[model samples]
Target: MREAEEFVDITLLFGEGHVKCHKVIFMILAGRSDYFHRMFLTSMVESALNEVPIEEISASTGVLLVDYLYTGRIKLTTRNAQDLLVASEMLLLGALKQNIEEFLCEQIESSNCISLLNFARM
Candidate 1:
């Protein structure tokens, strides 16, 4: 489905990037994420829009999210783990959030512990 991009009904827009996906897929993902549940299942303004601006998530993160929604898999790296954690938190994706948390935990070192904590507090 990711490759096909067929029957796409909505566009998630980042600053200079966008991802096209089917509302049906989002409807299915709603069960896993309350953020998606509310947006797709409720009478929210975004539910009716063809293009939804997502200012909080980066374009690369959005693409990874869509990939996960379709494939049930993701690759976590220090470069993307923190951003993924923030996105997962906002999306109410507990499992994904936990996965990112675990990955970040494994990456923590004495030198970066304080900085990581500060970023988390922010």
Candidate 2:
């Protein structure tokens, strides 16, 4: 369904249920920043997952993204980049891995052997 239809369905699904369910969901819609943030992050993650539908990604990469989404901080480095590729590769998350692979491949073509090598090794 389209976004508008999905939202309407959700509204109806909740509103047609227990009063408390409607109340709680309404409160979420009205005032929960955390809820919104979590949903926003989930949408981004899902889009990435769709780009490469794989079993899973590296635990470290998932943790890293989750941390960033929730806390807005990550100790990003030249290396976390490579690690993402490795994790994506292992998880067989094709769409997710494809994006990372594309980036690493470009780096390799440009002589960034370290990152490319790490990705290849993974």
Candidate 3:
């Protein structure tokens, strides 16, 4: 493996915010998401600059996304699951999306079923 500084080649800009990560982390994302694969491999500007701008996602959610990308773990709860779902969908993270969906499904019950349905539709 390359040294940390040498491996760190990409800057992900998220809604006027940004994060730095190793190219290896991005390789993991590319393997997982078609969106990221295309972004890194096919998008001329991003491929050349090694930078990606994610304007629609919040920095906190972006952090979560990166954490999941690197660590393969995410903290999902009722408070943040919805936003994470949106982020995962936007990022084309199929595994994370399915995880969130399954979590939400498990949370469904008599009281929150309708609310969960509405949220899912949105």
Candidate 4:
């Protein structure tokens, strides 16, 4: 779906980057995320816009989120996991946020535990 980019109805803009995706994907994600439900299902301004500006997360992270919604898979790395977590929180995706938190916890070591704690606090 990402490769084909067919029947895509929404373009999420993030800073200088953007992600093109289908509204059906958002409709499915609406069941799992209240934020998506409100933004795409209700009579909100975003529901009527073809291009929605997303200031919360980077376009890279947005791609991951959309891919996860489409494929139910994501390759979470230490570099991108933090941003994904923040994005999931903002999107009200509890399961995704928990998955990221668990992944981060599994990666914690004495060397990085304090830093991880501080990051979590933020």
Off by over 4 Å in 1: none
Q: How close is candidate 4 to the true structure, as a TM-score?
A: 0.92
lDDT of 4 by residue, 41-113 (tens): 8899999898999877887888888788877889999999999998999989899899999999999999999
lDDT of 2 by residue, 26-68 (tens): 2333232343334334555532221222234444565554333
* Model 4 misplaced stretches (Cα beyond 4 Å): none
Alpha carbon RMSD to native, model 4: 1.2
Model 2: weakest 10-residue lDDT segment is 12-21
Estimated TM-score per prediction?
A: 0.91, 0.34, 0.83, 0.92
Q: All predictions: root-mean-square deviation over Cα?
A: 1.4, 14.2, 2.8, 1.2
User: Tens digits of per-residue lDDT for model 1 on 1-108?
Assistant: 646877888888975799998888876788778998898789999888999898889999999997887788999988888888989998899999988888888989
lDDT leaderboard ranking: 4, 1, 3, 2
Shift of residue 59 alpha carbon in model 4, Å: 1.2
In candidate 2, position 64 carries an lDDT of 57
